[model samples]
Target: MAAAGPGQHPGNRARLIARFGPMAGPWHDALPTLVDGLARRWGLDVGEAGGGGTSRVYRCRRDGDHEGVAAAVWLKLTPDPVVATQEAEALSAWSATPSVVRLLDSDLRVGALLLAGVEPGTRVRESGWRTADVARLLADLRTAPRTRTPLLPPLGERITFMYDMAARRGTHDPEVLAHGRAAALGLAGTGPADGLVHGDLHPGNVLVGPGYRLVAIDPRPTFGDPDFDAVDWAIDGATDEVALRRRIAELAALVPGMSAARVLAWCRATAPLTTGAPAFLVTPAGLRG
Candidate 1:
């Protein structure tokens, strides 16, 4: 996918400050040193990678190795320890799938990873992505074998919290939270026949290569019905009612036995809960936590 451009989306430092207030003395003093130590230990030549609100990913190259042999690893730094660990475990599990990025190494203690970077391609936000590309990638991701890992908390819990927040904070949207709650309950008892799910499958998460071969990154793996996994893409970038409805229909058609109405309900219900909100306000890690 196209590399994230500079100063676009949300800034990582701004996100940290907004979420946790000002950085404390110890954490501020230690962060740069810790990152530098990690780079030296891993033989990485570090540079900036595009990022969003919650995490900042850095492009890294291993020293002494030629560019071809030096792996292009991305380091995602987050203040929330739980978010980091969840991403590590999810990536590790998805690594077993051939089309997904392999997790070469990770330190849950420090929330760092060494991953096999896919060749540069068009991100879903870029012009080249087609519906067929997304379809193929989702198909490949769904083929990964399932394991007995604990599922994330049900959508109901998150919806309930959203509703509660709306009532208490006077800033919550009742209709949106209600739609999410109903959809969550409906999905609670359903899942694909058997396989691992890329919990957050959106166009932005898909990487399209020559002939539009798809490789997915930033997965949130879970053991559940694969059909339930299309919600993220359906609601992504939908600003108007007509566009939103159409995208929902398009995505629902991609997964057999899943209806657009159901997916739309779920999307409306869950989007606010899943976006770059504070962890105390929403469930950031999905089924894993």
Candidate 2:
């Protein structure tokens, strides 16, 4: 991944101001001091910053470490307190699992997290990896020990909210949410709650890591049917019906407890709920209150 320029993502401040209105002012105002405080507290030499819409992320080097060589870490600062808390709790739950990035440290009060950076950090999407490979890694992540974190909503509740939001937005076709609701209900009844789910496990989020062949970043960390974690691959990027069906089949075989029919249901329900106006998109990233 490229180093972020200056503070957080380029143009992120403008976007935040636009999205957050008056309340955003304080968040923006506090960023400089927050960054400085975190740097000094953690002995981090904050470097370039970059991330998507919700947070400011930067590459930083540990200033001092008597234990061994000082390591490079990714520092993320989320504006949403709920998101910050959820992310910190999730990373701690994961505890450096091979499937996801490790959390080195965190300050929930200030919404700062020190994450282990993936060396040779290559996104799986850019790595020329096959669908099967991504599916295997996702399945592996679903196998991590489940953490009883109370921050995340249940899979069922989340699906209901998506439907309600779609109705409120009037952007997506009604039938889509209907089918999604039905699928979600069916999957909820049938699928096992085996582990913590990376609520957003698309290709952009999975990266090649140093010790792990594939590690995921930016997790929503919800408790749900493990198969729910496998649905993103079907509708993530460029794909047609044929491609989608093939990917679903491939994923089902690779991911235990997930089926082609179940994956299809999730896609039909999830795609419309996610791909829409800015509000719809940002809702899932913990931007919506």
Candidate 3:
């Protein structure tokens, strides 16, 4: 499947430029040369892998001098320092796990990664994945040890911070914000278990291949309850409100102790806060149903 570059979609590009401004154009223009140089220095072959939101990933081949390997590696390029650092730190933390992508190196200044790419497979959105697949992937991911070293805050805290930012920026809808705050407070009161949560665990981030095995990519690593991860999969987009609720119910059932009502509220609360976020972060279809 073809992936469109950042700003290629008129509507999305406009919103991004509005929020982030025109500086992205210059940074993007410099990516190809920067990636090429990095590949040469690292003794790897590099070329375009794909593009989404503010980053363009490249397919990289390990240096020929190294032992037996022919497949190219993958490199993700971006101008956002925080996001680049988060991805690198998360990948490094989980590198021992064969199921997660391997991170070879990262250039913080340029926001680039030299990574080991998994064999290509259908994205979860296109792979006809069911709720079972999502549950299984979550179970595997939750096995990673949780850390509170402050690489990224917990999901609940992050949601609260986003609300504060939106309110300060005067971009938040008051009713939605109020509901989100209330729901977040409720979730907090429950004292949900904390683990290494994939802050974004929607279908698009999942990849499936032979034997129906699933692997996840592009994690926004944070610490939180596993149930916090379910919201993204539920209310992505459904023209019919009832249908959306049903999907939420189905997903909540897949995750123990999670209520459909809580998931729905989280989805509604967070969606608006992401309105001006990069395309990779916020899907044009909104969430995905």
Worst 10 residues of 2 by lDDT: 280-289
| Per-residue C-alpha lDDT of model 3 across residues 60-129, encoded as one tens digit per residue | 5676546666566777777777777887877776666655667878887788777766666578778666
lDDT of 1 at 101: 66
Q: For each candidate, give its TM-score against the true structure.
A: 0.70, 0.80, 0.71
Instruction: Give candidate 1's TM-score.
Output: 0.70
lDDT of 2 by residue, 239-279 (tens): 45666677778778877767777666666546556542123
Residue-wise lDDT of candidate 1 within 1-289, one digit each (tens)? Answer: 2222332233455665655457522343355666677777777777765556455567777655654576677766656565567666666666665567667766657656666666665576675455555655666665555554544433334346555655565444555455545556566456343455666666677766555577777765555566556666655555555766787677556744556765555554465555532232232222112
lDDT of 1: 0.57
Ranking by TM-score: 2, 3, 1
Error of 3 at 128 (Å): 1.4
| Reference-based TM-score, model 2 | 0.80
| Model 3 TM-score relative to the real fold | 0.71
Order the candidate numbers by lDDT, best to worst.
Answer: 2, 3, 1
Residue 73, candidate 2: how far off, in angstroms? Answer: 0.6
Score each candidate by Cα lDDT: 0.57, 0.69, 0.63
